[model samples]
Target: MQDAAEPPPLRSRRDLVKELSLGMVAFGADARNLTSQGNLTPAQTRRLLPAGLVAAIGGELVASMAYLAMGRWAYASAALVRQLVEVEYLAWAVTNDPDDAWEWLKSDRQTRLQRWQPGKIRQRSDGRFPNSDYHAHCEAGGHPVPEPAMNILDHRDQWVELSLYEAAVHGTATWHYLVQAVGDAPVTAAERHHRLIDEAHNVWRRTETLDRGFLSPANGSDA
Candidate 1:
């Protein structure tokens, strides 16, 4: 019998993009097939979660590579990228609400508020976070956790959410501009990176949509 063939070595971000996108597509198909017949087996659920995580990671990597291609010359572009990062971080700060995060992304208002005073989530008269509980809990505790001097949402989950969000925004924005900014780079290199970033972003977007569409309702159904 012939030996199994070896897989090709990945050479660039583009390659990673292709791999990640393909994986997500496959996973989604499987998930749908399984759901249609019956619920996923425990093992399948475990596998799916990891694949979703991987897709999310790929999205961040793609965005980062794009920004890196732009180099220091794209200062305005870079700042915009940074703004994306900040918004993502703030998203986590406010809890993983994409709606709230995207809302802040559209305006500098939240950033300005955050920038001016750390952990300052604007609240309504009822004293609830406009959308989050980050500050409310901290404030209401009888022995209030001394607000960390710097970033307010400093907990591990909060930090990870912030970090992931920043990475996603920076990576996506960078990927979008990489081609224009790095045209001077070798053609093949540019194209590869661009494709990688695009693929990564697409995978992330699809995965997120799937998660929101499927998981949220499923959770509600359980409740």
Candidate 2:
């Protein structure tokens, strides 16, 4: 049973902006540091980071816009998945079910999200969503959502989380490239990004309880 004291789901654009902003800032700072270690001058490093940061920002913006479209169209299944997946992504740091994400992306983007709804739509005045209500609404329709790492299990009876892993992988890869570009074998940028990725990985592992008693995964501890 869920505690009545549980806070409502953050369902506002402002919340999205805040979360995305923090992630972008963290990512952008790392990007800048990596670039600064390269053959490029400070000016080039600055320019490179702004561009890369824009792409990262664009990704978040596009995702938010998609959620907005989902809400407007009352595509409850799609909307809920988008929202939940995003939340889980933020928590876990990797893409959840790349196959599913691909499927959503391949669907008709322009008109598919604006379809109709037949049920009574309830609105939250304070913009808070109770966990029970969210679970009820999101899972009632057999929506093929990816198993959440902290809360759900996958087909192999494994806790499947990906977003944090993806972020860590991205950060690590970028760090390597940046290290190579900067021509520094003992640079701090590489180590810092590596540490960030390690932090993200630790979060993922803890969320899944892999180090506790969970088992049957090669990526996790033998607990």
Candidate 3:
């Protein structure tokens, strides 16, 4: 049976993190707040995270946040798409079961996420940095992965959800990246960005098509 009480709406990133963090705190999970620490600083995380797998997943999240904030919808979606694949890598770290790890993609994220454990927070290896870096602070340091992170990596029908990000959002976010690639020079920038975005769209669509061929139909999605 599910909890009948509704949780409060998570309209901001801070809210989401706070909600997740509360549970982990009781376990003596990393105590430093992400905002207080370096939240999405990949350069810092890469060096600090003990496991390469954690670094990779954390890097993808950083890329997603960076691209999305810049209005690069396709790139943002791309980052998220990669996370779907990378979750398998993370799972392999935990279970060492290739078959089970691969299933992380087809797994229903919403259902699995409901089982998410509280996220860990750790003190920095050095005091020079005021706060803990999210990835390095994990219990594994760089080895085993947590079940919650595995669940968080799964995408809920990401094939369709990604399409919405690529197509349904009016391409405004897509345009943001394109504009920066070219400049305020007008025609050149417009043409350059358009071509770049179109190229990215085609690549993502093609990849999705290829991935569809491998999905297990038992997951309820049609082949």
Candidate 4:
């Protein structure tokens, strides 16, 4: 028996990865079942963009876990950036008129770029950014926005999130490359295992928020 004062042993990294993988698989299945419940009309089918975005997020999460297992932290970080993009896409889908959102999603790069060009993106009176302001948009749409949506849209840590995402995708930060070179050497195996567990928990939390806010029966019907 272990001493009462001692901390419990950490689970293996493989176990952590397996747990995360299983959770994602379950989420994917749930999303599929949710989307397949009833025959959708043509307009409804077009509005399935948020469901597609949720699936995209699941793919990014699985890719992130794969990269982490392969000791490719930078690639994993880049996957995280893609996941954030999916979240933004989901927000855009739920908040706007479905037809307009679908048109924008299917628009060519040049057309999309023209809409998002400098001076075109306006800040609202509530201090929220255009198109991605979940709180404001949800209120306007008479939908209840989830806490995660508000948390992310509040922009309190906007700079930090933006910097990390930019560094991961653009290789702008030296540590991004340096950490990949160093691999997991900076921490003990147990420490690394715990880190993986923490990362998995964060991903699950975000996934739950997305499911509840945009993919549940009540909310998904609107999409």
Candidate 5:
């Protein structure tokens, strides 16, 4: 029998984008919708989480390559691409951690919010973190044990939400300019894209550490 033919090679981010397109189709109708929403259905989350993670990385590469290839610049698309990376990382990180991580991801708010005192979640008379849901237990970043990162994770998740919102604003503004300009202006876009790449890399590493039990008793991070 003849030997099997060699597999094709990935030549560029454009190629990766095609690969992502395949992975994204696995998400069915909600693939595009889920990218912007705060919460995902359990079924959608299960199918899209891995694809989202890969998509984020692939998007970054595409943005970088496109930015560098440009003689001028495109700022808005670049920023959107970067923000997307952080957003995907946050989703993936939270979904993979915590006992009820999926439920956490399903929340309109990705983290538990409450007043924290010392190392515990403090109840408030003002009814803060309204309609309290998840317990105060978060381990993302380098937060040690006996600490109320439930509050912190809530804050971080909020920030990610806000960042993406701002990104959408800028993106809308730039898309108009990009259309008028015939193509994108690459200088500003490249700058923002590169910066976000660094930030995304750091966030991924930090979250991955948490996923590996960075705060566990065996890790010497437990307080």
Candidate 6:
């Protein structure tokens, strides 16, 4: 018999996107089942928080996937900011008194209280404040924190740790991707595509792990 032919190399960008999509679908089904099992009523505001967060995270992942597929790498990174926010919210729910967390969520003033003050504090005209510090909150809860691509908050040289999400949200450094060049070096379309795909895969994997942890029996979910 003739030897079997070698299989073609998998396309990293396409395969990763497909895999991420599948993971989102599975998570959605599991989330729905968990919500149904709880039989949560509108009045059960505390219990509703987890379900709502789960849905929100899933939606954020979908948005990220869409952006990645469309070659909007910066916007895709921006979409992940919500995932990080939701994960921290989940950590709060699992580690603290659910009632207290729920109360904080409801209060605009309380939620706006700044948890981190770096350097000289400047008052905001918009009256917005930074939320909980991501690393501290996750660490306090004994939950795994997703590895940050950049430390935009505490770094001495802000530009040294500029994150894609920050760039996309603020329109700073977005020209790097828009012009297909970084600093003095040119980034080919293929290189940029693969790089963002790898980054997205990492984010998805970490976020999924956090999601499962929140839904695990020890965290109080039936999942």
Best-fitting candidate, measured by TM-score? 4
lDDT of 1 by residue, 1-223 (tens): 2223422221223343344334333333443444345455544343333332323443444344344433422222222333333332332332333334334434476665654232443331234323232222222121223432122233333222222333344344433332232222222433444555566555455333123210123312111
TM per candidate comes to 0.29, 0.25, 0.23, 0.36, 0.27, 0.32
Judging by lDDT, tell me the better candidate of 1 and 5: 1
Off by over 4 Å in 1: 1-154, 184-187, 209-223
Q: Tens-digit lDDT track for model 2 on 1-223?
A: 3334432222222233233334444554655566666865554453344433432543354344334443442222223333332333222211222222223324474422432111111121133223433343244222544442213333212221122222223223333333333232233433454455445444433333223112224423222
Give per-residue CA lDDT, model 4, range 4-100, as digits (tens). Answer: 4432222222233344334333433443443466554555445543334433354345445444434433223333443333343433333444565
Clashing residue pairs in candidate 6, if any?
none
Tens digit of per-residue lDDT, candidate 3, span 12-80:
222222221221121111212221366635432322221223323433443343345345343234334
Model 6: lowest-lDDT 10 consecutive positions = 116-125
Q: How accurate locally, in lDDT, is each candidate?
A: 0.34, 0.34, 0.29, 0.36, 0.31, 0.34
Instruction: Give the runs in model 6 whose Cα sits over 4 Å from its true position.
Output: 1-45, 69-72, 75-86, 89-96, 114-223
* Residue 108 lDDT, candidate 5, scale 0-100: 51
Q: Best by lDDT, which number?
A: 4
Clashes of each: 3, 9, 3, 0, 7, 0
lDDT computed for candidate 2: 0.34
Give candidate 6's TM-score. Answer: 0.32
Residues 17-81, model 6: lDDT tens digits: 44333433343344345456665454343534443444335434544544543553432343344
- What is candidate 6's CA lDDT for residue 133? 30
